[model samples]
Target: MTFESPSASGLTRRGMLTGAAAIGAGSVGLATAPAAAAPLTARGYRTRVVLAGTAGGPPPQDGRLGICTVVLVEDRAYLVDLGPGAVTAYARAGLTMEQVQSVFITHLHSDHLAEVYNLFWLNYGAPGARGNISRSVGIYGPGPAGSVPQAPGAPVQQPEAPTPGLTDFLRGAVAATAYDLNTRMAESRKPDIWNVLDPHDIELPDIGASATNRAPDMEPFEVMDDGFVRVTAILVDHPPVFPSFAYRFDTADGSVVVSGDTAPSDNLVRLARGADLLVHEVYDHAYFATINPRLAETFSRTHTASDRVGQLASAAGVGTLALSHLVPAGVRDVPDQVWKRHARKSFGGTVVVGRDGDTIGIGGRTK
Candidate 1:
């Protein structure tokens, strides 16, 4: 049986109109009408977590590699993680770097954040390179906030300690790019070279930037002026690496949770509990066990096993479980049916194994 879409969650006509208004401000001058204007019953919002890179064990024929990128689209587009293949994947997904409003990093794992520099440069190089528009894209994630003092058991003194702390590691990169941006602007005689230009050479800044960058720490939690959607972020354990987060997105239509890279944790279960969709990272324990013991050990440390993922979804009673962050063993080999079988043994809900570009429409009846 198919699962009910989030639209089927029972949104009133007024609720739909409210959501539409929330996202409308950004739709000005668009070639096509905004998706939000579509009837809520017609599946107004579409969220896709495009697979940027998928690699573990032996490489695939396409030369892809380890847990990579994903882009989350709502009223505005937000990129979840930017692994190695993110740049290429973004292009493949038909997304221009300028269209992305903010980048929400799950954690600082190289595999997840590798493309940050690429995305930053892409945005920074846009026509209005030095303008507020270029600097408008916000990047949020967990990292050391300040100096680590030598005090014993001293609460690991991270000076600023914001929810998604800013680390110094990225400071140099931003500084290094200054000269290049200046050179490009001077040579082109254009201020916003990196931005997408209209026929008249006018740059189109991401409309969502103003609302999203206003409060970085309060992200996925604060509701935009549109009033149709709200996002909340909760800390989850992905230790050795402290402070990973699971994000929950609530809209007039329904709720969806993105379980960023993390081992099975109660925080995730609670974050996803009762949501219409749970997009989680899953690793193949059985396959890894046979391929390489060391790899298997690493998998255990970094991610949730398939069975454990299933259990979490079942325990949380999510409406649908979409497995993602796949490793080598082909997507079809993911034992999708097994998840359904076991989850049914427990939760008896719909289980979906996410494929690259697979779109799961929420908030509507199965047509």
Candidate 2:
């Protein structure tokens, strides 16, 4: 039951060296490593998770983009969330949108969903998306909040249907772009928008989950089961945002859990238990408190701190802990080494301080 600890160079477990390789000119490990030394490819691993965009929050950071993660199994790509710069990052990582089979949204947060529509609208019928021209890309996300959670000074917009789900969101996206979509369909050779993106609201089983008690302790439930992979979901503790989820992707090769946005929760640990990799969100309490005390207080309750991530990873018994969705994501704001040091304090497994395009190979050779 013993696990090999990470080396200073990279994460090594039982002779498995998870790449932690950066696709940009950034440090790949605790020590200085060559930039882009390992290009992203499906050759080495049976499954891999690419950190498409690492920065957290709505405002743009200096080097990193917003939060988006891609779990790749062979040629098929399953995306967890699509943030502002995810589409472009997908191309930059030498991957085409055609490779994407399904897209999962953790919550309806603007930072996590800003570019979701753009992902399909811009790419469909384009040269890169030729392969899936006839196939509909599945979009799965939380259903509508049963009732809006109360908050001070927060006026409800769209009072008729205060909270909309994935289906409604996609409907709005198409409506907002109706002019463009119609024009392209008539003038340009764009295919029917409906045929390109298929949206679904995930049906939550009766689990006593509500806007007030957002994340109740429960076993992971099956979300989707494509022939190649089985996806399961568990509610995580990101309050005021009901139905926020952490997802686990299991393939024949291995499993990885994407902790969408949450404070440390046992539900997450249970969902990610014994998975080969745990990709989790992290915030720096000290740094954010100095910048904005009010926002820091909110983050402290909703997101996991860097120092506490390892404890969750250890509790989950994940092989490696890859930190993404970083708050205060600027390279100058908080260095990678700081994240590594903090995470290492509580867990013995490998900890990867994720950069925008870093790809970590799992259950196979390190790239």
Candidate 3:
């Protein structure tokens, strides 16, 4: 796989000092620029993966944004997960909202879906983006979980429909922003939102899955096939967030898998098997273990550590492993080298610690 950061202007002394000051100030500096021709070339490859946000969880971190990724097939963009600031990051990556053909959500976590509405609402009619959405863009995600999971003896919040699916979430967004949508329709005569955006709830086959048995071992099933790419999903172990998924996109160029928040799940390994690129999430076990032991323990059960991610990639025989959705995403708290070191301990293939806008290309004439 070929890797490049779109805004890698090379370390300037001023930029170095600025980064240092931001780290000292305990603030994340996640500024990115539009794509350049050199980065987009991809050595003649047709398929590429762009890391929009690398930070995991809700709280913003230093040097990293939330978790979002874009898979590019020629000019079309298929997005996976729209975390905080993802809409802006998508634009910063030189991707026009008009190029968005489909969106796949891994789960309903706030950090993962924070900007789901913003992506569409903001891009619907921006300058140079108006009247361009002729085809419906499909947004797919897990359906509502039948039941909610809570800690033993803990009371469940929003017991009724505790887990809203993608369709329900989109409907709620429309309702919550009814005033604005209505005003735009009356004044600007904008196209109906439903006419452009198609939201769907991914249906699951009978595989003995449940709120408790979140990810029973199963085969990766088809979620979509839009001629350009064939998308498949499998249950991944992110407990309490039932129906959590890991998606794989198979294109003529090659295959790329996005392991949404998960532990070292066999289901993920299966979904990613033999893929060219596995963009996986990772946690800093050492950092979490020191700051919050209980939370670290909980994360260990819900997330895969750096070494475990490496093992999973190795087991899947993926050509490359790109690590994103970092738990402690701060450069000061968990440096890139630290993440690389832990992952390399278990896997021998290429390990890429992705930053926002970093592009990984597969197949074609490799660089």
Sorted on lDDT, highest at the top, how do the candidates line up?
A: 3, 2, 1
- Tens-digit lDDT string for candidate 3 (1-367): 6654333343334334544664321211223544322233243568878887888988878877788888999878899999987776676566666778999999999989999887777667534422245468899998888887666898876776777788989999989988998999899887677786799899998988988789998999999998999999999999879789999999998999999999889999999999999999999888888999999999999999887888999999998898999988886788778899999998998887877766777776533
lDDT string for model 1 (1-367, tens) is: 1221113232334334434564411110110112222211123435433443443322342334344444344435556666665555454433454456666666666777676666656555434322223435556665541222244665643345522233343554546776876786798553652342211111112323221221112223331222534666765656545446677777655677888877777767877878888878777777779989898898797678876777888788887777666665364555556544544444566665543323345564323
What's the TM-score of each model vs. the native? 0.65, 0.88, 0.90
**Winner on lDDT (2 vs 3):** 3
Give the runs in model 1 whose Cα sits over 4 Å from its true position: 1-75, 123-135, 145-167, 189-228, 329-347, 365-367
Clashes of each: 25, 0, 2
TM-score-superior candidate, 1 or 2: 2
| Cα lDDT over the full model 3 | 0.80
lDDT of 3 at 38: 24
Return the top candidate by lDDT: 3
* Highest TM-score scorer: 3
Q: What is the C-alpha lDDT of each candidate?
A: 0.52, 0.79, 0.80
The parts of candidate 3 lying over 4 Å away from their true place are 5-31, 34-43, 126-134, 152-157
